[model samples]
Each structure stands twice: as C-alpha cells, then as structure tokens.
Target: MAIPTPGQPVRGSRSGAPIMALFDLLGRRWGMGILWHLSQGPCSFRELQQRCETISPTILNRRLKELREALFIERCDKGYCLTPLGSDLQKLLVPLGAFSRTWAEVLPHEEASS
Candidate 1:
C-alpha cells in the first residue's frame, strides 16, 4: 500500500495545511523518536529498535514507511538515515530542544503553583 504524504487530507484539520499534515504524522507513537535517533547517524532496523527501546517492530516498521514516503529519510546500504531534507529538519529541531530544556526547568515551578 502507498504511504500518506503531506498536502493530503489529515486528521484534526480539513484545511490540508502542510504543517497539520506534518504534525499529524510526527505526533504518532514513536514518530519523533525515530527522527531523533536517525539525526545522529544511519542505523539498521535492529539498531533503531535498540535505540528506541520498547518500540514494537510493527510500529517501527510503520513509522519508517511513513518517514520514507515523506522524503524525510531513506534506506541505503549502511542502513536507514535522514535524507537531506531530514537533516535540515534536524537542524530546525535543534533550537526546539534547547527551548524544551528551558521549558522543562520552568514547568515544574509553574505546575507547583497551580
């Protein structure tokens, strides 16, 4: 079966916004984890499974298919790795990781006061 791609209809929004399509895909179970691990370097399916511990083979397979269809990653002799587009995505996510650390530190205090 063909995998879904951005610019197509997606859940939670009918506008067909590219961002919504992206979010819908990434928000799936272990989707982000797959990207994060691939950001470092190429990895075989087994290696990916080890890095993303607790992910069942079924879900991992599904996410890989989705990522490939999105042009975010590709499979090569070395293993599965990010495409140039995916590497660019990793660059974009770097700042978010920094922000997350800051948010993480502040969130506990805010929650305690609530």
Candidate 2:
C-alpha cells in the first residue's frame, strides 16, 4: 500500500483526515514498532531487523522506505534515524505508552482467563 497521505483516501476515512492517515500509517504491521525502536537511536537495516526479530527483511525494507517517504525517518551516515517531525510524534506517544502499561496491568491475561 502507498504511504497514507493527508487529503487522499485512507483506511476508514474517505476524506483521509490527517489524523486518520497518520493512524493508517502507524497502524500497519511493525510500523509503530520501528518508530519506537528508532526513538532510542539510529539503527542500520540489519540492526533494525534484529530489534524486530520476527520482521521479514522485505517488510522492514518496505517500512523503512515508507517512513522515509513520510519524512518521519531519514537515512544518515549512522543509519536510519527519526526526523524532527518523527521525534515530536514520538513525544506525543509517550503518554500513550504509559497508559498502555497501566491498562495492561489491569487487563486479565487471555491465557489465565482461559
């Protein structure tokens, strides 16, 4: 799928609202994970693959390309790193991360419930 662009059709939104487009991109498999990992520091392709242990090279390459096109990441001498816009987005997600941890603590595990 092409990178979700604002004003273009995206999942769930015919108008492709900016936020919906963002959600479409980040909601993709391993998309948010890649960004989260890169928030720590830059990583080479191999290193990123190692970080996302189950991600196929093809998918990783695709995600990297998509992220680059979105201007959320850039290829630098060191490796792939978050762009300024990406950093801002990451900061915004920090609260969501905290909320998820708290929610996880309260939610019953499926295995245990079973």
Candidate 3:
C-alpha cells in the first residue's frame, strides 16, 4: 500500500496535517513497537518476530508493508533496517523515551483517585 499523501484523510483527521497522518499510521497496533525493535539494528524476519514475541506474522507483514510505503524501513541482504529518515525518527524518539521513563517513575508516587 502506498503511504497516504499529505492532502489525503487519515483515521480521525481530514485536516491533512502531515503529523496527524503520521500518528494515524503509527497508532496501529505494534507500530511503534516494531520501530523500537528495528532501532537496535537490521533484523531478519524471524529475528524481528522473536523480538516481538506476541505479534502474528500477518500483522508483522502488514506493518512492514505500510512502513516501507512510508519510506521508514527497507529490506536489505542482511534484513530489514531503518531508512535514513527512519533513523532520524529514532533519534527523535530518544527524548520521548526519556519522558516515558520519568512519567513511569512519577506514576508510582502520584495519588490514587476513587
């Protein structure tokens, strides 16, 4: 499948914001997880499947197709790895991971509500 063009509608947004389109794509199940695992390095299908222990082949193939369409990943002789654009994206995710760790630490201390 081809990546949705900028003017095309996606998920809940017809506004055609590029960011919204990206979120719509990445919001799919295991989307971010797949990217996270790929960040470690290129991986064969079996290796990636092992990393994402719970994902089914059907979903993994589907996500790979979509991500390729979006130019975020590619299959090489060794296996699948991030494209340069995707590597840049991985860099951006580093700060988000830091924030997530901070949030997780604070979550345990936050007051519970009835």
Candidate 4:
C-alpha cells in the first residue's frame, strides 16, 4: 500500500484532509506502536522488533519505510530514530496518553464474548 499523502484520498476522507491522512497512516497495524517505541530512543530492526513483541518483520519493514517517507523517522548509524517532526508529534501525544489512562479507569471492562 502507498503512503497516505495530504492531497490523495486516504481511508476515511475522499478529499484527503491532512489530519485524515495522518490518522490513516497511524491507524494501521503497528504504526503508532513503532512511533511510540522509537520515541524512547534509536533502535535497530531487531531491537524494534523485540520492543513491538508481536509485529511481524514484514509489517515493521513496511511501517519503517512509510514513516521514513513521511519524514517522521530516519535511519542513522545508531538505528531508526524519530525525526524532529516525529518528536514533536510524540510530545503532542503525551497528553493524550495521560487522558487515556484516566479514561480507561472510568470505562467498564468488557468480558470476552467467547
């Protein structure tokens, strides 16, 4: 799949609003997980795979390529690290993380349907 671009149609928006495009990219499997982990520090492919426990190598490679193309991450000698833009995004998400914790506390837990 091609990386979601601002002007091109994304998953939910036909007009492809920038925010929608961002959501489309980050909503993919392991997309947000990769960025969140990389925010901690640089990690090589093997290290990142370990951090993201269940992510298959194929999906990790694809997400890395897409993130790099989007200027959110870059490969350095150390390994894959977040770019300034990605760091900025991570900062923005911090508050959302806090809110999620609180929200989780309030929400009723769902039992498994089985």
Alpha carbon deviation, residue 19, candidate 4 (Å)? 0.9
- Candidates in order, TM-scores: namely 0.85, 0.91, 0.87, 0.91
Judging by lDDT against the true structure, name the best candidate.
Answer: 4
Residue-level lDDT of model 2, residues 1-114, one tens digit each, is 789999999997999999999999999999899988889899888998898889999999999999899999999887899999989988888898999999998998667563
Query: Which of 2 and 4 is the better model by lDDT?
Result: 4
Clashes of 3: 0
RMSD of model 3 against the true structure: 3.4
Please give the RMSD to the true structure for each candidate, in Å: 3.5, 1.8, 3.4, 2.3
Error of 2 at 49 (Å): 1.0
Q: Which ten residues in a row are the worst by lDDT in model 4?
A: 105-114
Q: On a 0 to 1 TM-score scale, where does candidate 1 land against the true structure?
A: 0.85
Better of 1 and 2 by TM-score: 2
Name the best candidate (by TM-score): 2
Inter-residue clash pairs, candidate 1: none
How many clashes show up per model?
Answer: 0, 0, 0, 0
Give the C-alpha miss distance for residue 114 in model 3, angstroms. 20
- The model with the greater lDDT, 1 or 4, is 4
RMSD of 2: 1.8
